[model samples]
Each structure stands twice: as C-alpha cells, then as structure tokens.
Target: MSKISKLFKGVSGSSSSSKSKHRARGGPSPHEAIHKLRDTEDMLTKKQDYLEKRIEQEVAIAKKHGTRNKRAALQALKRKKRLEQQLTQIDGTLSTIEFQRESLENSHTNSEVVRNMGYASQAMKKVHESMDLNKIDDLMDDINEQKDVAREINDAISRPQGDDFDEDELLAELEELEQEQMDDSMKSMGGLPSVPSGRLPSASTSYRATTKRREDEDDMRMLASWAT
Candidate 1:
C-alpha cells in the first residue's frame, strides 16, 4: 500500500510483538512498562524533529531551484511530502504510547489502592481480635467503682475525728473565762492604794477657812440685795 500505511502497520506489529514477549516472560512491571513507553516516545519525538527539519530543507531546496531547474524542484517537493507523511505517522505512534503509559499508571495506582485497602482490613481484623465490647464495658465499670471508692475514702479521711463539739457551748465557755479574767482584773485594781492630797500647815488652813467664810457672807448680802 502507501508508505504511511506500511509504516503504521509495521509499528503496530512491533508493539504487539513486544507486548507478547513481555507477557510470555510474566509481563513487565508497571515501572518497566512505563520506562519502555517513555523511551519509545522519546525516540519518536526525535524522529519527528528530524523529519520536520528534512521537510523544511526539502521545501527550501524546492523554492531555490523553482525556476532554474523545474525537475529538481519537483523532486524536492516530493521528498518533503514523504517526510511530512512520516512525521504524521510518528505523531500517531507517540499518541498511542502516551495513552498506553497513562493506562499503565492508572492500573498501577488502582493496584496500590486495592493492596492498601486489604492491609487496612486485615489490621482492623487483628485489632478486633484483641478487643471485646464486653471487656471494655467491664473495664469502664471497674474504673467508675474505683473512683467512687476513692471519693468515699477521701471523705472519710477529711471528716472531723472524735465526737462533734457544740459551737454554742464552746463560745459560752470562752465568754465565761473572759468574764472571770475581767473580774480578777477589777479586784486587783481595787486593791491598789488611792493617791492622797497634800496636807497644808494648820495655821494657813485656819486663815484660808476664815477668808472663805467672809466671802460667803459677802455673796449672801449681794443675793439679798438682788431679791429686794
């Protein structure tokens, strides 16, 4: 058929053969598969670049010899067309490789997710095996009972020891003692000797008494005059 068609078929056949080989060998790991795809894509990209450069060079040659040599220009144009076709095929192949790589990546991600989920389930089963709902409830009950016992013990220790004393009786006894102390203080104060006034000379006292009697007479006379 056409060169492009032939090239496409050849690429497809080679890819199929590689896949079959991998499968026969127990299949490549996801990483290996991705690496292979990347390598193939890189090769295709380089080929595409080379084809594009060749096509550009062919187009340039065709334009330069357009009028001077018509036959040479036509041949250059034909080669450019062929290179363009090959570039198109490479683009298609690169697209396929990219799709395959993405598919492998998705599959690898799914496999990891499933494996992690399985591990989680197993861990949960193991945890459940070590624990019982009944045992948990019993443990809680024991803790509450111990807390109650501790609180009661604390209350017992905090309580006042011996018989309870009457507050009013204690206050009354304290007041009685204070009163007796105050009475003893008063008796002691009463036993203290009184201070005496100074004694005057007998002659001076007689003279002072006479002068006081004369003043009292003068005051009596003044009072009689005021009454009249």
Candidate 2:
C-alpha cells in the first residue's frame, strides 16, 4: 500500500479508538487534548526541518562528486530520496494533528456556549418562581390609589377655602365711592361759579373758573393715587 494511505489508516484507527473511550475512560479534557496535539505538531515540524536539511546536504554531496565518483554520488542521491520521503510523512502527520487541535477548540467553545445558556435558563426559571402575578397587580393598584389621593389633596389645597366674592361687583362699588368723593370735593369748592347764561364772564370771573378747573384736576389726581 502507498505510504500516505497506510499513514492515514493508522491515524484513523488511533483517533477513532481514542474518541470512543475518551469520556468513558475519563481521558484528557479538550484543553489537554489540544495542547498535546500542538506539542506533537511542533515535534514533527522540527523533524521535517531536520530531514530537509539532511536532504540538502545529500544533494550537495551528489552534485559535488558527479561523474568523477559515481558510487559516492549514487549513495548520496539514495540518502536524499529517503530523507524526502520522511519529510513528506511528517508533513501529513502535522496536517492531521492541526486539524484535530482545531476540532477540539471548536468543540470546547460550543460546550461552553451551551453551558452558559443553560445557566441563563435556570436563572430565569428561579426569578419566575419567586414572582407572583397577583402580588404585582396589588402593588400597581396601591400605587394608583396613592396617586389619586395625592391629586385630591393637591386640589383641596389649591381651592379657595371660604367666602368667595364677586370681583366685578367689588370693582363697580369702588368706582361709585370714587364718584361720591369727587362730588363731595366739588361741594367743598362751593361748586363752579355759575357762568352767566347770556355772555362771556368778566376777567375776574374767568380767573375763578380757571382756578376751579386746576383744583378739580388736582383732586382727580389725588383720587387716582389713592385708588392705586
């Protein structure tokens, strides 16, 4: 059988058996498995490098002694071919190990995800177990009742307490008192001298009338100030 094919069969047999018994036998965890696989890969990579260097050396030997020393050249070529075959096998092995490590990493991630989800579900279930719908409803009802009571209290505080008065009637009565005071002031002035009906008043009479008008204006100003 071909070397590669034989190598694949061997790897498959070992891997299958390991997987079948891994959990049952309490074997390595995913972390440990991946770590071991990585270690194997490193070792095989080193071997590959060594084999390649040896192959290079053999090729150099064959080239340097070409034709002049056929036997030595032929021996070097044979050694080179064997080293190349070993390098090829190490390459295949490294590929398999890398693939296995990646699988373990992915599986470990999936396991962690599932476990955390289960924890979340259990937490929700516990929270639900502690809660009662009836109690929640009662709490809301109490809150609403307190709100309504608060509104009623605010309304009571804001409303006028007693004896509501008509603002418009009070204003009209105040104007009437101002008019009566003005009439009393005119009486105190002995009233404007009656203008003679037929003709303009004498200069003296005009002077009294002007004085009377000035007094009336002053009284009106005083009344306005008092109102303010």
Candidate 3:
C-alpha cells in the first residue's frame, strides 16, 4: 500500500512539474484560453446530445414496461433523472465557460482600443511639438504679404503701356481734328463751279454782250450831235 501511495505521489508530482514547465515556457495566452473554452463547449454539447438520447431511450423503455413491469419502468425513470441532472450540470459549466470567454475577449478589445488611443495621443503630441499659434500667424501673414506682392506684379505686367495720355487733352485734340475736316470739306465745296439750271447765259457770254451794246450807244450819240 505504501508503494502504491508512493507511485501515486510520484505520478502527481510529475504532472505538476510538467504543468509548471509548460507555464514557464509560456503561459496560456488569452487566445489559447478562448480556443480551449470553445473546445470544451463543443465537447459538452456532444455530451448533452448523448444524454438527451439516453433520456429518450429510458422514457421509451418505461413506457413499454408500463404497469406490466413496474420495477423496470421505475429503474428506467431513475436512470433518466440522473442523466438529466448530469446534463443540467454540464449546461451550467458551459454557461460559465462561455461567459468567461466572452469577458476575456471584450477585455482584449478594450485594451487594444486603449493602446491605440495612447499611440494616437503620442503622435498628435509629436506633431504639435514644432508648432505654435504665433508661428502659424506669422506664416499666414507672410503668405498674405506674398499674395499682395504677386497681385501688384501681375497688375503691373498686365497694364497697357503708353496709356498715360490725359483724357481731357485727348478729347480736345479729337475735336480740333473734326473741325479741320469740316473746314476742308466746306472749302472744297465752295471751289466747285455752279451749273446753270435754266436758260441763263454763262458769265463770259453776258460780258461780251454788254460790251458791244455800250459801243453801239456811243456811236449813235456821236451821229445825232453831228446832225444837230
């Protein structure tokens, strides 16, 4: 008996040492824990199915033995009750394991979110390290000044050259030119000869007629005096 006890103790010690060694290598991560929980749940589910089948079979037997064999029916019902109890226990265990798994998963997600937020905060801090309100304002002012200068340059470049003439002087010169043109046109019209529209004699013909008439008159007068 002592030897048997020693053997059992040796077996237990070896199992414990193996577990400690495994833990030393790397304890079960959350992911592994979740996987283990899922496997356990699946095993429990199969067990529950088996229990349900056994319960059904017991019920069928109890029905078959009805009043003819009361003892057999009683025994079958008892076995069914025990299986139901085991099924209940397994259901409770599965519920606990599932709740733990879900809680761990939620914790992991929250931790990741927190870690990422911390990283983001650091990045924002780094980005802001080189910046200040005053510097930004100065930059903006410089940009505005440059824009103003550029606009002035563009205006100067785009302006028409030789556009310094006075408006009033230009208008006066234009009026003088118009007047000279009018005067020239009038003089040209006056130099043109007028045409006779009716049967009036021309200037040369009228002059010649007048001269002959005067000569005739003088000759007639001389003859009258000689006669007197």
Candidate 4:
C-alpha cells in the first residue's frame, strides 16, 4: 500500500477508536488516576471507622434520654454502607479503564482518551461522592447532639415541676420577646416599605404608639379645661 493510503487508513482507525469516555479532562493516565482513587478510598475507610465509633457513642446517649431517636446514627450507618457498595463498584471498573488505556490510539490525542477513560471509572466518581458523605456525616452529628441536649432538658422539665413557673415573669418575657421581634421587623420593614402578609408590629412599637396616644389625650384634656 502507498504511504498516503496507509496514513489515511490509520486516521480512519483512530477516529473509529475515539468514543464518549475519551473526551479529554486533563492530565493523569487512567492507571495513575485509578491508583490515586484507591488511595482516597483507603483514607475514607479509616475516617469511616472513626465516625462509626462516634456514632455508637451517640446511640448510647440516646438510650439514656428515655426515648432513643437514633435517626442520626442510623442515617450515618446507611451512608457508610452506601460508601462501601460504591467502593466495590469502583474496584470493578478499574480493570475496564486500564484496558481502554492500553487500547488507546498511538496518536498525540492520548490526553483526550485518558480523560474519557476516566469518565467510566467508578473510583473517580466515588471520590467525588465521598465529599457529600463527609458533609452529611457532619450535619448528622450536629443534629444528633442538638436533639440529645433537647431531650435532656425535656426530661428535667418532667421531674416534679416545683420551680415556681412564674406566670407573670413568663408573660413579661413573652412580651419583651414580642417587642424585640416587632422592633426588628419594623426595622426590616423600614428598609423595604412593603406591607407584610398578616403580621402586625411588635409590642415595643405598640407601646410607643400607645404612649404617643396618651400624650395626645393629656394635651386634649388641657385644651378642654382651658376652653371651658
């Protein structure tokens, strides 16, 4: 075959070889990427083990609370199991990507091929997925601790309620809280001049308005007395 014909045939073969996964993402051969991904998975396993221990501790605390809503611990376990299953799938995909790398064309476009071979590797995807798992684990731990504190407070409240639940003081507190909230809302409204749906101004604003009204009433009385 002529050199031109041979070159044409090779180009045709290269084009035929290029597929969806081979779209270039950047550096890193498929083998190197898989190795790095394996390392990441190993690190996650250790982290998962530590989180697992903390989860057990939370479970024990929930039991002491009289009502064990182990939702956080249970969800953590579920997410850990999900990571395990994903790790297995990642392991299985490694060989397929390696094969694709070996079969890649000798042309200078191996980077593109490497990039696409990476796409099908579940290990690469799992590393990204692990980020979300870690975030969720933190959220679960926070919510669990918060709930545990709330439960402890509730248990205390149930005990022979002898502390003179000062009704007047409580009412005053509610009024103060309502007033502060009203001031905050008014300030917010003052910034944007828009009427709220069904809410009214807080107690502080009402008190101020009442004071102005009383002053007006006194001034009217003085005027009436003077005129009479």
What lDDT score is found at residue 52 in candidate 3?
99
lDDT by residue for model 2 (1-228), tens: 999999999999999888888868788788878888888888898898899889999999999999999999999999999998888888888888888888889999999999999999999999999999999999999999999999999999999887699999999999999999998999998987876789877899999999999999999999999999
lDDT by residue (tens digit), candidate 1, 104-161: 9999999999999999999999999999999999999999999999999999999988
Q: Write the per-residue lDDT of candidate 4 for residues 78-112, one digit (tens) a residue.
A: 66566566656655565554455445433326777
Task: Please report the TM-score between candidate 4 and the true structure.
Answer: 0.21
Q: TM-score for each prediction?
A: 0.55, 0.53, 0.55, 0.21
Candidate 3 lDDT, 1-228, residue by residue in tens: 699999999999997996897689787777777887899899999999999999999999999999999999999999999999999999899999989999989988898899999999999999999799899999999999999999999999999998798999999999999999997998888855666789988899999999999999999999999999
- For model 4, the local distance difference test gives 0.70
lDDT of each: 0.93, 0.92, 0.93, 0.70
Error of 3 at 185 (Å): 35
Off by over 4 Å in 1: 1-25, 142-228
RMSD of each: 11.4, 16.0, 12.9, 40.5
Model 2: what TM-score? 0.53
Identify the superior model by lDDT, candidate 1 or candidate 4: 1
Ranking by lDDT: 3, 1, 2, 4
